[model samples]
Target: MRGIADIFGKEWATPSAVETLMRQNKPKGFMCVSCSWAKPADYHTFEFCENGAKATLWELTSKRCTPEFFAAHSVTELRGWSDYDLEQQGRLTDPMRYDPATDHYVPCSWEEAFQGIGAQLRALDPKSVIFYASGRASLETSYLYALFARLYGNNNIPDSSNMCHETTGVALNKVIGVGVGTVVFDDLAKCDAFFFFGQNTGSNSPRFLHPLQEAAKRGVPIITFNPVREKGLESFINPQNVTEMLTGKATPISTQYHQVKVGGDIAVLIGLCKHVFACDDAAKRDGRRVLDVDFIEAHTKGLDEFEAKVRATSWNEIEAASGLTRAAIEGAGQVYVEADRVIGIYGMGLTQHVHGFENVATFVNLLLLKGNIGRDGTGISPVRGHSNVQGQRTVGIADKPKLVPLDRLAEQFGFEPPREKGMNTVEACHGMIDGKVKAFIGLGGNFVRAIPERAAMEQAWTRMELTVQIATKLNRSHLVNGKAAYLLPCLGRTEQDIQATGPQAVTMEDTFSCIQGSVGLRTPASDNLKSELAIVAGIAKATLPPNPKVIWDDWVGDYGLVRDAIEHTYPDMFHDFNARMFTPGGFYKGNAARERIWNTESGKAEFTTPTMLSSIGFDDAPGRYRLLTMRSNDQFNTTIYGMSDRLRGIEGRRDVLLINPDDIARAGLVDGQMVWLVGDADDGVHREVGPLKVTPFRLPDGCVGSYYPEMNPLIALDHHDIESKTPANKSVPVKIRA
Candidate 1:
């Protein structure tokens, strides 16, 4: 029999295999790609993404995280399995706990697990329990998670946002007073120009290709500035449409691509500002308004201080700091200045760093200064991932104190919300290391892989009183067992969601403030598996103060009631949520963002200065490489679907790291040589993880890139954004050793 790697390697040579891969993510019977998961997708679906197809197959595969499977394998033994192997063990059917004495997992009934969980909570001093939520969670499920934690007397809702785009939230709120992208499908198509910073949209958001392709055909220039020259940004093939697929053709992307050095994005933003201000100065001398004159007069503050900073910045400094010449900055700025309307989009490449918030703030500054807010075909978009990630944060998922939300909860629920500032991902890790946090409840995510410091993360998860995961499939998190742990299997996007009343649909908020309805099309693979809402209801029934006519039951039984509650919770926004969702294409109306009526301390979009901390963004040495953490085409986030990164011509291994030929020569290493990564962990700790193979690829000089989870060990749990605590998974210093 062929090995798994060999099987994966062999699949590519077959024409049928190539076609299968091309059609891997075609929009099957579903109306749109977003709803593809709702139906029993043609496994050989009509259309889907490679990663999406892999994720779907992985979820629906014939594997089981059953008691029998866990009974024989020791935690120590299971820890040694490959990520694929662990997940391939199948869906977790019941709750279980670790038995160190036997070195195996022992089955524990649902009732016993919850009773023990309740006991563990009672033992906690309220502040010690960390509630970790993932973006994959449904809005209804998210509400319950927050409610449960809040009722437990602590707002320790350390969520997925803390690790991903939470800094975007912080920066956007400071400027626009809302924390989501302002553009949609139409915005991308109609824009005269689009600016991409610190993000590779092609790999990160495959769905974005549709609009990007349309924009490219219409001659709308898309300028990309990233440290690495991601293949996705340069070109792409759309499998959804047969013309691009059958012809084996791809559309060339990026009118201009600028390869900036890691941590140099802030400098680039500053350069753009200098050019924008220069144009404004030129326009003022000519006695004509290029920027929105009335909006600038009535709205915005700190322009005087900001203008001073822009004028103070020399061309030499901007060029040197950004790794882009003065000419390049002017050339890019010319587009922004000449264009009537433009959209700026970005992702984790900006957010996962020390000054991530600053980078985002700088972009917001550009938009507000140009009076881009409250306008059609112009805005800054922080391209979001997962289904309803933004909605999670909107409905009180933050660990920080939200004055109005707590007050409303108190008035409505007859109890005061927890006053303590809760633990974030970093804080949770710290708490675990210090023994302050005794329990952790992860809603959905490969928490072990997602969190930084692999050794500490693994140790912490293994030490928990309870580590519960509400997941659709077996992941690294499920195997991250504690003394008492639970892996409760749940329904996937393709499964049917049956409530007490009838089948129900879930809702999701896209990158733009568009809220739409989502319903599953396929039947549940197993009868035991529950919907996320049902699981939340079950947990709430098991944990909450047992009120008659439980809110949990009502929300689970009918998602419409959940929408009604959402309307009540966010009256200004979802006033007529039920009636609106019925509209075919759904809704994209978010007033606070669209109208620019900011709900801040002031009532308009504001300007925020960029805060540069170069010391934290890069290595101290001149030649040290700044490596970015990335994923393969067959992967989504940390869920590795296959061994090949087909987009880059890599296969059979996850150990290969991409580097430019120039950087390769400077490192004095061969293409296939294995080397150790040298770096200082944030806590004055020296760390080295090795045997990573070097592969030649298109990346900037003085920069190297590696796939995540494998390189996660090198990330210091303490190396995080100062304000938002998002892990600095990007731009870490490293010296490759022989």
Candidate 2:
């Protein structure tokens, strides 16, 4: 009903929206731009979820932010508008450039926009330019973007992964020698148990609920550990199920849902390991094997040290840190001990903390104890938010010098790629503030809104020499124009992308590493909009000096040539790229860890030991609440779809803070009282955002919740994972005041 209302209310063509939803996630149709969950091998006509429908319909809307609309509104006025209003103005129709004289954006030809951007790039050192790509871009476009950055003389390419899953990559690489999740979609069906930590499945990726529903019906134990009791984690009724829809019966998702304290994931993980070790000690005495002794002995290392550390940690400390009773922790542990093959899944909540790296490493350590990885139905799965985030990183949109095959890339493009390490998202922000970065080029995203320290970044963004955004719609980032800024309109994923060779099919990698092809079916929102591939090629052609080896025009004309370049650069992963992409349900780029071929230093899966009991070193201080930034049911990333969060009962507003009743009373605040959330960062910066209505909920005491990007102002710029540099958006210490 909400999906239907949003579709029709947005004035999208009903038939086209319906048809697009039906084809979304299908083998021959376009992929959903919402989430990274993989499509089932057995296809369904209605594979798309509510959020997926909203994302598709959003792109298919008839509303347009034409040149006339921009001419009427100044950049200063647009800056005062809410993010929802800014995007609701609709699809960008023409290449627009910021006019400082009028403080408004004026229409310009594509050629002029490219040339102006190119001239700015040439004026500044390549090291000073930031090439940022969002997950919305295709692999072909990302490949070109990365290649263009290297050809222009630097490797300063940072994508969406740097914000969400950077810690996952750093942690997994150290433990299993692979950064991506080892499990495929089939693993969900075969796993005896599933352990989800910090992930809200129902809202983040609704299509994933189908598999969870099936698993629950089969009596598989689905354990969840999150601070908030997400409705999706509780119960779900499959809209596609005829009986479920008619009878209004819902399937129970989580068998045991533990509300672990914010930043207490490490504590819970360690406690679980402690129980497993105790169980193993008793089992060995009784001549019964509880642990995977054979598997562990054959393919693991550092277990002795990790086990010692877990045993050394007292249960009382664990209980205090995790905010759970001993019985509850032991009960969850018992389930883990009983299950033969358990799949451990997590989300950004585990990775967006100061100890984010340790959070992931701890989870991997728990899985490694029982040899849970390297087997069917058992491994680690980091459920990503964006559709093509993993794909962007896979195709080499990375800031690290060692992550990309620079030599292979140089050979393929006949250009000496820069080998110096580049900046991640956090570093990029710092670079901009320090006046070290001169230009900012975004492929597709609301960069200004998605990042932390909103006030600081907004001011620093204006100081840049050049800012270019290749996007489908207007966003807050477009308004934070540099001395010179250009907005290049691009085609959406659902719309047709035609080139010289005919229609082109771009590919996206899901959370499971399945490379599924996405072919746009609907006519583009505007005839003036160009494909992301063409836009990227145009910038590359205008910026780089003429080269015989690189043919930007040809690559834009034929996307297969881009795939061929990707194959040449990443031969092992993308071999036979063009043909394999068309395979039904797509092809799985195999994980080395799945095959038990560990790529670690010791050639074995490693058990990592953390020195700390918890990520945040909060001593249960009075008046201090651990605040976690989250997405509402109505939003995807930073893009607000609507004001209502149906799952949490939030409606007609977003400026509400969810808190526990006890905490609200302790702070002398009522449920409907308006309060301010002041950051306790102690960074000499006064950070606060409020007049937020206090909504008492069933979260743990001393833990509160608020929507992300809105609450991002309270997050300090330096508050992030030291190793991965992912902002600690999940765990910020704050005080509530009237």
Candidate 3:
């Protein structure tokens, strides 16, 4: 309740917002602005989580950052403010542009802002502009952003997925027919065993605790593979559970939690698959069948080669690389061997590494070893973080736009979309660094703060000729200006988006590919603010030439027209899109993997074997710790609710480094000691971030953890997964010094 009150102030709170909360809070109501965890079709009295409520309150807060407020604070002054301070100044009430002479943001008319931006955009080469979109925006906004980019003859539409789950999609596409998870939310309740590899659901996706608790109550095994024993995974007391909350008792979450060292997930996964093969050999000797030979032969390819590779991998190498005992790895295999159905869930801990793409494929390989893809209560579930991230990618926002989607766009909209692939997050940063990209526009996100190599990104950003941000509040990105910077304030998800048609509702896709509706019920915080759809349409209308093929005004006014366009673009998937949007719990875009139909080049699920975890020259060093970045429970992405991380047992600070006690003693460091962190990257790029206070934590030996964005500077922009091009944020070789 304090968390809720802190985000949504007390004095100016409205009863109408409460009514809307009671009416449409997701799974039963509309949708939420939190994580993209999938919701069941069944309805509940209250379907929201604590973090979801905090997100809602943060958006609908009564405070306002009016024009007068900006007049009092200059851009230089605001830069000194922390991330919390900048956003907490209040909601931006009007569109503002940075004035160079005064070092301040001043209000400008919407038309003037759009015209100036459009003229500047038209003056530059198409390849020189970069359009970045975040998951927070709706599908309509992302679609328009992509369309506008392609219409302008450029494909440089890099999005938040580039930093989060691009590896998941890329890996899944190669292994399976589709690049999405196979199971829906209901599968969580039906699975006999749940295997979590490098995922801390407690802090990332709290709502998952509901299904986990229920599964645990039914005596199902919940096995976890993480370096640190997170509190959310150990035990959880659901705030919505009256009995548990009143009694102060918590339900168990992880029945068997194994601490795998950072960057060791692929090795661990290989060990598990190898164990299953050994079990199959023993069953054959006993004249019994343990392996799904029928499924393997009929539904998959490359089993012979995959099995040979698994057999060639020695147990000694597996144990050493995985930082696990042979018995523990085999024990996990035994659990999987006994269970008829299993669900494999993984988070960034599995995806944010140099071998992130291979790490994801390893999970798929483990599942396919048991034929778990197309069965009840079983499949691969890659839990995405931001809400609607899946949806944005589903509609159009791909850097490498596939031929099918591009063809669909041309057939539906009567224009030839750009065929060339564009820059991803890493490439965009490099483009800026090289002065190839001149303009940068964000749909909704703090791009500079979210990306890696912050120092370099900041320098690259300043080199740009134009930078525009479409946001709800001030962030570090707005302050880090280019030659010309503009901030276009837009309505939040909790505020009413009254368009020319009427009150508007946007649709979002969850982690499981479930599409749902979201309708804000509160009055607009500022009449000067516009909806994301309107903002996109305004820019497109100003920038693009008049054409009968596309109608920007009609599409923005009535989102129904946008839905119709989407339906026409993806007929097989989004047919009757408008009708499905009104369904009680939204419709599911079924994955072909769930039907045992492979869509790969061979028309069968392929088993991919990855050779390396890190690059070839990754030499191991003693007294060096592998540093990974994570968010505290009090924060969501770049937004700060408070500084305290209650679950992690920290308070009033974000600069604490979590180090293993043994490693601390070995490094000759004491608890609460201040130390500087220097990068040990093999690329010869020097980077440092510190004077961070070191705190002894219960993590694996030679492994450490710190909050992200603060540690972003340590990650070199060029260091990423070679296949997916995602920045390796979870594993950075660093040395600490007093």
The 0-to-1 C-alpha lDDT of every candidate, in the order given, reads: 0.72, 0.89, 0.84
Tens digit per residue, CA lDDT, model 1, 265-337: 8888888888888888899998975677687777776677776777788888777777789898889988888
The parts of candidate 1 lying over 4 Å away from their true place are 1-47, 548-550, 611-619
Number of clashing residue pairs, candidate 3: 0
TM-score (all chains, Cα) for each model: 0.91, 0.99, 0.98
Task: Name the best candidate (by TM-score).
Answer: 2
Candidate 3 per-residue lDDT, tens place, 1-738, comes to 566666566325565667766655464355778898765566556676667777776777778888888799898888888998888877889999888899998989999899988998999999999999998889878777788889888889888989988988888888897888898887888899999987778778887888899999999998999888899899989887799889989998888889988888888888898889988989999987668888989999987887788889888888878788989988998899889899999988877888888899888989998899999899999889889888888888888877238877887778898888899999999999889999999998999999988887888888888999999988999999988888999988877778788888888898988888888877888889998889888988888898787999999889999988888888888999988885655688778999999989899999987786332124569756788888888888888778878888989999888998898898999999999888888778889988899998988787899998789989888778778888888888888978
Superposition error at 499 for model 3 (Å): 1.7
RMSD of each: 4.3, 1.1, 1.6
Per TM-score, what order, best first?
2, 3, 1
Residue 177 accuracy (lDDT) in model 1: 79
